[model samples]
Target chain A: MSTTRLARTGGPRPAAAAGRGRSLWRTVRASGWSYAYLAPFVVLTAAFVVYPIFASLGYTFYDWDGIGEPSDFVGLANFKQVATDGYFWRALGNSALYTLVLVPVQLVLALVLALVLNNPRLRGSTFYRALYFLPAITSIAIVGIVLKLMLANFGDAVSKPFLKLGLTDEPLQFLGSPHLSMWTVIAIGIWNTLGYNMIYFLAGLQTIPKDQYEAAQIDGAGRFAQFVHVTIPGLRNVGLVIVFLAIVGSLQVFDLVMVLTGGGPFYSSDVITTYIYREAFGQVGTGVAVEPHIGLASAASFLFGLLLLVVTSGQMLAIRRLRARKEGK
Target chain B: MTELKGARARRGLTHLVLLAIGFAYVYPFLWAVGSSLKTKIDFLDGGLGLLPSRPVWENYAQAWREASFGTYFVNTLVISVTTVAFTLLFTAMAGYALARHTFPGKKIILGVILATYLLPHGYTIVPIYDLINSLGLLNTLTSVILAQVGGGLVFGTFMFMAYFSTLPRELEEAARVDGAGFNTLFFRVMLPVSKPMMATLGLFTFISSWNNFFLPLVFTLGRPELRTVGVGLYAFTNQTTTDWTLLCAGAVISLAPIVVVFVVAQRYIVEAIAGAVKA
Candidate 1:
């Protein structure tokens, strides 16, 4: 890329021309090739990622049935409806609960597991890793089916026995009840992600050199004290990355939730993405199925996308602040 | 006597916890596998044991035949293999570009790739559908392939770039002096030397593509013929809610490729993840 630019600019000092010209021609040739190489990614992203983001914004203002017709430009009406919408609020709340609950619990569990598994004396370490990380790679399709069976109600092979044995009056309608469905979604999300994030924590744990622990030990610090005094502080960046990233990821959650409960017996389990899908594809308005409210769905998606951007940017800013405080330049 | 007693108590407790947790993880898999083998009554019975009295291997055949999964199997295999190969080539090339070249726009390009992953595909599904449909490519294997190639390329590029940034540059420089062009040097020198990175990257790409649930879901749009394994598996269960034996068999069958990859490339995958952590 540079070679082409250099050649286009025409010359250098006369003495260095022969050598530098070859370099310039080479640079120009490489530049042409570089753009050619990079073109496909650029085109795909522009077509797919970049255009969709902008189109989503444009779509938010218009009532267009997904299949056909000229879109009706509805102005800010769709956005206003979302502001007072009950189901929209519930979806937002469920999504928030996932972020607020699942991310923290998952992070803590991951940290503790990483610490335990990072123990140099630990045996069967590889086996433990494979066991734990299996879910990270396991199909969420299969996860949904297995978890559904485990979490089923009456006549369920597993849950029925527990209910029969007087575990509870009735098996908890996990996917049915509005109250439990969100938490169930959150729990599954956490389980799906725990291994991948824990590996990051383990990495962070490894970076806290043996010397720091040795230093603390020499100073008569106990293991727990050393963990608090050194390890927690040491993992700040990794924590920020995992936690912030987890929040963004959890908000984007779709597949397993869709599988476990088609946004539920009620609208209880509805999340932004599921809500978007339902609006676009399912009961659109109030009659048989809801009328396809493409505008409302688009508006909700934009708001949801904005919420993610704000949270991530906030975390990034906090990270910068933390780093500044540490360096104190 | 006291020290020994304390040691034994702690050991017992540790093993007990491991055993309990082990059961939680292992039982689901066993149950899934077990369900595939059982008759409808036994499956419904949900016995504590994984063993099937009859051990019906015919469920596998039935599932394979019933779902028309053989067609989807070919679709999936083609998509995954081709996607992985294309992902491998492009990502490595791009990774090499970003890693070796002190080029303008490198950082910006990397940032764009990373950010693409962050934006949920759920948000982009509509326009991508629109875009694909406009091109009259709806429900084509190419649409699924393109969706994956597009989606998978971002992370694949990022991961490879992360690994490649640390690769030794001395060889590239020497190859340049040997009067080699960029292609020859990359092919003969740097590419050959990036064996470990290529393996792990390929494993990573294949696994993601193999198990990708979403891309094919929306793009397939009810086309039975064009579905990949993941979406095809979904269609199987959705259509036949009662016949879970066949469904579970399909589940096990779909997972076979990934399990094989994991077994073979287990060590490299671990080290690569571990290496990323340290970096």
Candidate 2:
């Protein structure tokens, strides 16, 4: 079917002998099939992913309500507004703080879990693995709601233990206090993501051959020394992937924050995505409905997206350089 | 003999530590399930104890009736099923083409997909919203389905590509020599051999679609009847924030399908994650 279509569409061709022409026809036929396979995916991705990316980039340079077309072309005004806006910087800082605190804690805990459970001799390792990973399956939105309730001012779930330990005399408003809210969110972030990260590390751990450890033992190396030498290097790639994912994922944290704090208690816990939400849709209960400013939201997100692209690209470049230097040594 | 005893002791210590950590990890979920059966007063008064002095199963009935979870269930099912079906087929086809064929512009196609892979959903939400609005597809399940599948296709293709690349080329060569067409070769031969990858991709697409919050939230803003379970529970909690018992019941209701899918296909889920990151 496509072979005839290819022949019909052969507008330009290189002059060649009969044998070469046959092979060229064969090449065209093969490409026709490949194009058929690729057509649906390329079309859909262009419609949604590629086109929307450039569309949003174009939106950043204009001032438009979300409903209609961009009438006013305001060059750099929206970008300047977002850059100087106090809330935007605050939200960005909060997101960075969360990532800073959340990534190491999550990675370390997950690595430790994987190391402990990587033992083939351990009984019920599957059960433990499944148990640890249970939270990953639950929707983060539900997790946020449940965590919010558990940490409520009068709720005894989180407060009772702290009270018994005499950590605080009063039942602390974990979600209500501005200072404590972000920390609570960060803690929940680690909890919700711990299992998934552990799975990554576990997969990484499995790929390291047991012979390496045996060789280290033959050389009279201790467990800690072998781990430092062999395990770390073996896991370096997986660790980089995990860390990059954790950073990007935490940077865009929204659903949990939406359901949990709603950037509450004087907007102390607003992250970048939530800030963008407010810019686009306005705050939920601010008496009068604020106008939806799609242009400003697009600008903020565009800047944020650029930052993400640069950070990720930089990370990849750094990793590649490190690997090359290590190989050279 | 002493080394053997020492190794046993170390293993015991490890198990003890793991058990304690695992308990802490899973306790919140257990507590939520326990709280659902308690009365409001009982739950507040019972503190950390998981046992309910009064077991009230009616909470499930009430949450189902009041929250319209039945409607949400069907709505989410339709969205998730259609999205997963389209995502699996489209991505698999793309993956097969990329892996098994040589073509002009192939590098550019792969580059485009990879670029889109790194583009986070946060930046695209506004334009996607505008795109949906312009197309007059807002507030419809189809809009969410289209967006979700498009978003998922890249990673799915990545996974399938990795899997397909590892397969030996001889089988395909033999089939091609026997006059098998491309479609027949893929569906009859390659698809059967690629079951594990398909399972991994399908489970992932299903779970993410089922648990998806942002797209569904933004798309179906005012359409309560068309809300997915995630958004339905969110709305329920917003309306009844203090009713812990009812909220827990609603949470349990929403979690059931995903929990079942996870328990059934958990190995593939983990493999999918591992393969995705590695690929």
Candidate 3:
């Protein structure tokens, strides 16, 4: 609807409306009003959004701490350093691992939950849905911090329960151990985000015609077969939305890590954003201290941004191609 | 008859699994709320327990007073309210204009807006931080509000455009025939008709700005007084790592408003989130 309106409004001027000179003046006057209406959006986007993107790119080329103007023009040095930086690569790899694991797991969990809750005969679905989604609305920083406290050394709440259940003899350093920290972060991530995805899938599922299932049932399809044929196909668009968002969101994971581990256990849990933050803002007490490298941070962010764009676009294209092929078949 | 019995069995099992998962999902917040009411020693003892032995309500007061959560709450309110207000105003204006009229460079502007939606703020945050510093707005609520509103505008505009496009053109045409100007047409005609969409976007923006951590953490790094609840809780826990009772209390305090708002406006929230998939 909006695009059609946009096209209608933006279409070529009617040929017989007026003389050329007067029509040009009318067009100019109309544009003036439109620009007047859009001035705040334009100015704010230019100042805040557009400027920052180009500025960050420009900052990547020069050696300047975040405080001052760039005096030393070190061409590609920041890029070169980032190229060889193990921590930067590690951060990217960790983010990749997170996106890889979290997206599909979150989607499956969300789909299952959505399907279960979508049943018309289910009792207390509203309460259960609200309960499950409570964490989705809370501050992630607070959740991460509270979770860390709950899961603290052996006598802590989470650890005590695990020990009592005979899951382990000692406290599991979920956020403390390097190996477990990232996965713990991923788990908390999935837990917090699962409901949001569930909502998406539920919305998608609600749009499917109920008679499709009725048709399948009449054709002797079992529940599982109906789910596979009717429900999964119905959810494709919603699944794509979740996948795209999950990829973008996972790449930008910072708040949880900042509060939970601060990329601790020797930078083992660092995502690109945390790594960039420490590089730009300087983290202390984390055992991986480097002088605040604003230039390199900017470079790393820019490079990562490019990589994310490429990955996202590539995935979108792949989805498109697959859909096209499916339609063709 | 056996098939009917099997269906009943399946339904019972489904409820069992749902209830169990719901408990696991909600236990953390419940634990935090329960722990917040405990003294330090009691907290450690009953940390995982749903009920506190002695509910020390004063823990809330302690967190409120000592942690300066009052200031953080005010700061967050100021930031979220201002950000949401500006986001609604600017995006609505932009959306109405883009929807109702065409101008030179409209395509370019729309393309840029769409691109901004895809571009994560994390990548450009360094320069944004620098930009705020250069403007002398660092460590101020204004800086965070400005950035939040700015970051929120594109999506808000997108939402507004989608809604405004669907609105009947006859209303605007009638207003124009009555000799109403652009301001009257928009402020009087369009704004009144667009309340539902506005509410959805306003809640969306408010919740996000309220929960925003990373930007405020950057902007208010030096000024603790300017910290929002998210950043304040972060700073609080960092300083008082051993005070689980107080920290948990602070967490509950910060989470309380959100929970209440969420419960009250869950329909709107769910609708907005679900609608986001379409956008």
Index of the highest-TM-score prediction? 3
What does the interface RMSD come to for each candidate?
Answer: 4.1, 3.7, 3.0
What ordering of candidates by TM-score runs from best to worst?
3, 2, 1
What CAPRI-style quality would you assign to candidate 1? acceptable
lDDT tens readout by residue for model 1, A229-289: 9999888877777777778878887778777776775877888888888776664212346
For model 2, how does the per-residue alpha-carbon lDDT over A1-329 read when each residue is reduced to its tens digit? 34324334544444577677676767766677789988989988888888887888888888887766788899999999998999999999999999999999999999998998888899989889888998888789887787777777245556778999999888778889898888888998999988889999999998899999999999999989999999999998888888988998899899888988888778899999999998887675334376778889999988898888877887788789878988899
lDDT (Cα, tens digit) per residue for candidate 2, span B95-158: 9988877665777988887777765655789888887888899999999999998877888888
Between prediction 1 and prediction 2, which has the larger lDDT? 2
| Ranking 1 against 2 by DockQ, winner | 2
Q: Candidate 3 lDDT, tens digit per residue, B58-127?
A: 9889888887888888898899899989999999999998887776578899999878876655488887
Expressed as tens digits, the lDDT of each residue in A23-112 for candidate 3 is: 656665656767888999988888888888788888888898765688889999999999999999999899999889999999889888
Cα RMSD (Å) between model 2 and the true structure? 3.5
DockQ ranking from best to worst? 3, 2, 1
Candidate 3 docking classification: medium
> Clashes in model 3: which pairs?
none
What TM-score does chain A reach in every model?
A: 0.86, 0.88, 0.89
TM-score of chain B of each: 0.88, 0.90, 0.95
In candidate 3, stretches whose alpha carbon ends up further than 4 angstroms from where it belongs are A1-10, A14-26, A153-169, A284-290, A326-329, B1-6, B119-122
Worst 10 residues of 2 chain B by lDDT: B235-244
